[model samples]
Target: MDFNGIKGTYDVIFSLGKNCLVADQLSRHMLRKIGGVLDWVESPALPGVSHLLRNQFMNFMEFPNLAITGINEHAGCYIVRDAAYHIFSHHDFPLPENTPTQLLSYPELREKITRRVPRFLDTLRSSNRILFIRTEGTIHETAELLEVLNMQVAGEFNLLVINHAPVSGIVETPWPFPNVCALQIPLVPDEFHDNDYLWKTLLEGFHVRY
Candidate 1:
C-alpha cells in the first residue's frame, strides 16, 4: 500500500466514480476488483487475519431501491439528491438502497449534473473535514471528480485519492491543490504479477458513486 506520504484519518468512501450496471456481471466484477485495490491500501489486513472493520456501498438509480437474499448486521444505504450521491456507514442516515435493479453510470450522471459541479468546490472552501476519494481514472480526472464530492459534503474535509500510476501526458507534480494528494494504484492489478492477488479476490463490491 503506497501511502503517497499521507498520514491522518479522513472522511472518504470507496467509489469507482464510474458507476456500472449491477446486473452486468462484467461491470460489477470490475468494481469489486477496483475496490480490492483500494482496500489493499486503505486497510491491509495481516497475513491470515481478518480486518477489524468494513463498509458497504449502495447504488441508487433514477428511483433507487435494495433487496437482500442474505443477512447483514451492519448495513446502510447510499443517499442521492439532484443526482449527487453519498454513502454512509449505516441506515440510520437513511440513504437510497436498491437490489441491483437499473443501470447507473456515473459518467452519465456527472454529465446531467455538470452545471452543479462548481458548487462542490465551494463547499470545500467552507468546510473542515478530510475526504479520501478513490478513482479508476487519471489524476486530473480524479481531481475534477473529487472537487464535486468535496463541494457536496457540507463539512470540513481533505482529499486522499487512490489512483492509477501517473500518465506520461501529465507532467506536473505536488498536485495543483495543496489540500489534495493521490496514491498511485491500478484499475486492475495483474493477477500473475500482484503478490496480493489472492487477498484481492476476497474483496466484495461497493457501489457508492462519487
Candidate 2:
C-alpha cells in the first residue's frame, strides 16, 4: 500500500515510546484537531511490545531519589517534577517485572489500566483505519505487535505505519502485510527530545480542515 494513498480518518494514532517526546507531541496535535489516544500512557525506556503484551498489572516502587542529566532540554525523554528517576515513569507508572504485589494495590495505577485498556482495545477493534507510529521498536518487534492486533481484533483495518527514521521519505514496510503502508520521516532516534521543531513540522503537514 502507498503511504499517501491512505484515505479517510484514523481510529487512533498511537506510539510505543522510544521516549515520551514524539507521543506527547503527536497526541497534542491530534487532540487539537481530531482527538486521539493519550500518549502519556507509555514509558520512556523503550520497553518492548512484549512488556505491554504480557503484563496487565503495571506495578511500580517509589524511587529513592530523582536525578537530572544535562544531555537534553527534555532531560532524558521523561520528566516529572522532583520525581525524575527512570523508575518513576509517568502516567503508566508501573514496572513490568519483579514488582511487589503491594504496588498493584495502588488504586491509581489499577484504575488507570482498568479504565484505559478496554477503551484502547475497543477503539482499535472498531475502527476501519489506524495510524501507528514507530520510533523505537525494531522491524521484528513491529511485526509482533501487529500480529497480536490481527489475532485479537475482529474485522480488518487499513494500517499506516509512520516510521521515524534517520533518512527521510518513504521506506520499505517492515512487515509486508497487504493492509499496511509505511512511510519514513527524517528523525534520528532520540532527536525529538532536543529538536522538537522537526517533529512539529512533520506533524504540521497534516493540515486541519474546517
Candidate 3:
C-alpha cells in the first residue's frame, strides 16, 4: 500500500482520539483535492511522491492561491540525499544469508562505494534540472559542496541545500550559494532513547492546519 494508505491504517490501529480525527480529516481533504485514489494512483511513480502529496495538500488546504506544481517537478528537480553508506549497509544487519559479500566488509568495499559517487554526481550534473543535496556525514563543507556541484550542474538551475544533520556543524560556515537555502530540523532520539516523546514531538512539528 502507499503512504496515505499506511497512515490511514495507523490511524485506525492507534485510534488516538483527536489526533486520529485530525489525521482522518486531513486524509479525506487530501483525497478530495487530489481527485480520490484514482488520481493518486495515476500519479507518476516517483521517489518523492510523499513530499509532493504534502506540498499539494498544504496548497489546497492552507494556501488556496498558491500555484503548486504537479509531479513534473519530480523530473525537473532531482533531490539527491546521501545514500552512499545506506545503499551499501543495507546488505548487512538483519538481512538473510543471501546478502551480497560487499556488505560483509569484504575487500575494497569503501573504495567500491566511493568510486560510484563520481558517476552518480556526473549523472545528476548532466541532467537539465536542479540538484538538491542533503549531505549526510560531511555536514561542515555542505555549502561549499553545494556551490561546486551547482556550478557543475546548471548555473541557472536552483540549488537547495538541506542540512538534515541534527547538529549545526557545517551550517555555521559562511559560504554562500545564490540558489541555496538551508532547512534545519532538530534532532530527535531513536526509539531506544525516548520513543514516545520523540515521535510525539516529531508529529507535532509536522502537524498541518487542516
Query: Considering every candidate listed, which one attains the maximal lDDT?
Result: 2
* Model 2, residue pairs in steric clash: none
Q: Encode model 2's per-residue lDDT on 150-173: one tens digit a residue.
A: 765565555445556667544655
Worst 10 residues of 2 by lDDT: 76-85
Better of 1 and 3 by TM-score: 1
- Using TM-score as the measure, the top candidate is 2
Q: What lDDT tens digits, residue by residue, belong to model 1 across residues 24-98?
A: 222333432222112311121111011111111113222342222222343443333212122211121222433
TM-score of 3: 0.31
For model 1, where is the 10-residue window of minimal lDDT? 47-56
The Cα local distance difference test for each model comes to 0.33, 0.49, 0.28
- Per-residue lDDT value at 13 in model 1: 32
Q: Across residues 1-210, which tens digit of lDDT does each residue of candidate 3 receive? A: 111211211101111111122223334333211112112112122222223222322222111221222222323321111121111122112223223221233233234434433543444445443323232223344444444544454323442222334652223322344444444333445312323332243223222111
TM-score of every candidate: 0.34, 0.58, 0.31
What candidate 2 gets wrong by more than 4 Å, as runs, is: 31-38, 41-47, 54-88, 91-105, 160-165, 168-175, 187-190, 193-210
Ranking by TM-score: 2, 1, 3
